[model samples]
Target: MEPAPGLALVVVSPRVAPGLMSRSAWQVVEAASVRLCADADEPLAVAVTDADLPIQVYAAGSPALLARHLVERAADDNVVWLGSADGDEGLSDAIADEVSRLNDPPPVEVVVGSWDVPGARLLDVVAVMDRLRSPGGCPWDAEQTHESLLPYLEEEAGEYAEAVRSGDRAHMAEELGDVLLQVAFHARVAEDHPGQPFDIDDVAGGLVDKLVRRHPHVFADVEVSTPEEVAANWQKIKEEEKARRPGAH
Candidate 1:
């Protein structure tokens, strides 16, 4: 007798663009006899339908009912469940409970479609800053200006320094996050500058350029073995950068 078809639950990261899934995820999604999702308007679901694949969107219901439906459907044909970005809360446990009752349950697998890359959470910080400054967002955040935020910036920096002095790693991390919030807030305020508009990306890009330019030992052909030599190289790069400035003599 032929074995029962399996079910593949595909989970994707909201940080990643829709339809950009892993090879294994695409394979299971393409091979599945039935594709299911809770919402038709979800990013992944829209992407799947845009690719001309037939996917059925079930109305919002209880997790147990969804789990039962998935298991029953998987008995005869392969099934693919496109998980939501916020995660299909409680659905996995429900499925586990449903399968446990079956004497001969079909195999079930969770396929990771996409994952967040390093520093991906920084995007979330930027997004939050944007929302806070936008209309209908926080009134205080919207009203903040770079000049007005200077006191906050100084306070956060002082707190971070105190955290470092106390040798408290957790406090240092929290204080560092506060410092980062000040940076994001200033960048958001900068966006409204009429003549010199700049965002967080511009701030990051400049920092990236400066770091690459100074780190010749890592990025370029320059060779430096000792920390002293690296420091010397950094100072030399800084001097060169200063000399290249518009008003530098």
Candidate 2:
């Protein structure tokens, strides 16, 4: 008899909530007679139990071993492969290449169980900036002031603009990081202001408040149908904000 008709490869992100996984993936996992993970101690196993499925741990090795095992186990019963954040793409690739060369290949399906939230790693950037400015931190970072960082800020901004103009995605990503570094650096330096100390949260909070206020179409019931209307509305909101400022004339 031929092997099972289909196999499931469920990929999950470490940071993502297990409940957020797709219903189809859950169905496959729930029906799985054999569930396997790369490691038993991995949090993915914990998430599997949380999802109300029994997952068994396996020794980590080449994808060929896993593929062969899945093919064999799936021959007798439904098998589910629960993968990690990066989703063992290497093993998956190797499995695909190996199975393609064979005369008989069991159908394999891949699904992402969960996805990482966008911009989640940015918190690391903020934390690193704060640590660099903290007590007993980097001496150079500790002593730098707004005046000292101004030149670098200007330079980074120029480079970022040039990258944007050139439309080179690689250069844009690099230059954008440089610009963000300047922002984080400035926010960190402001923490030492004798009269007024402010951190990245303060900076981000103000920006958030400003953005929410300006994008009334998004956050409020204000209806805007066109990009031009949105831009005009943002300008109007900015003027109102400026008028309400303490020193505004």
Candidate 3:
């Protein structure tokens, strides 16, 4: 599918609850890229004053400990939440930090805000940015043309391929993220043109949905004994789909 142009911000927030973090003690806030840690002696109490920033707590070994700390140190105006350790909740849907379990009473001055930091949907980002760039957005990103971005996309793809060949997991991860950025950048560009469903969500969502529809064994009841059988099934489905197209051989 063709790509469109858009922008996104990666933010980290404080982990509200904890279970196990002797391993990796960092977590990202869904709305903004603010990281929170309980292991550090110096609390980021002053830093959490930003009203726009989202909070995400990592409940590694002790949920109570993390929750109490956030409750005590968090600004009264700042929003906080005690969420599950898993990445199940987005920055916008998190619960507030003020409410506490009766078992452990911690000094609390911060009051909870009902408002949660709403996460920006992928499609929403595209639609909003497109509107902004329409004789309205900043001159730089708005002035960019598709051809100008081709080099960047090519560079990112090459880096991804090289990273894969190198067998360095970290490099591969970084490269893959850059490739994603390229996809988003291209989508944003296509969106500027007419007669196109140019958006990053459409590109990503279509690919995900297509993969699930194509892989019946993984998404549906269909089963296969061998890789050859799987390939045959996929081919049959593709041929049937092609037959419905305007031209097929």
Q: Where's the lowest-lDDT run of ten residues in candidate 2?
A: 1-10
lDDT tens per residue, model 2, 20-132: 67787777777777888887656667777886778888766777777777776765676788886556767788778767876877778887777668986777788788888
lDDT for each candidate structure:
0.92, 0.81, 0.51
lDDT of 3 by residue, 1-249 (tens): 211111111222333212221222222222223335432222332233332443444544455454444444433322233322232243222213333333443323222212224543344455555665567666776777778878988999999999999999999988987786666667777776777646666787788887888899989999999999999999998887789888666
TM-score of each: 0.93, 0.68, 0.47
TM-score of 1: 0.93
Question: What does the lDDT read for residue 108 in candidate 2?
Answer: 80
Q: RMSD, model 3, all Cα superposed? A: 15.4
- List pairs with backbone clashes in candidate 2: none
Number of clashes recorded per candidate: 0, 0, 32
- Worst 10-residue stretch by lDDT in candidate 3? 2-11
lDDT of candidate model 1 versus the reference: 0.92
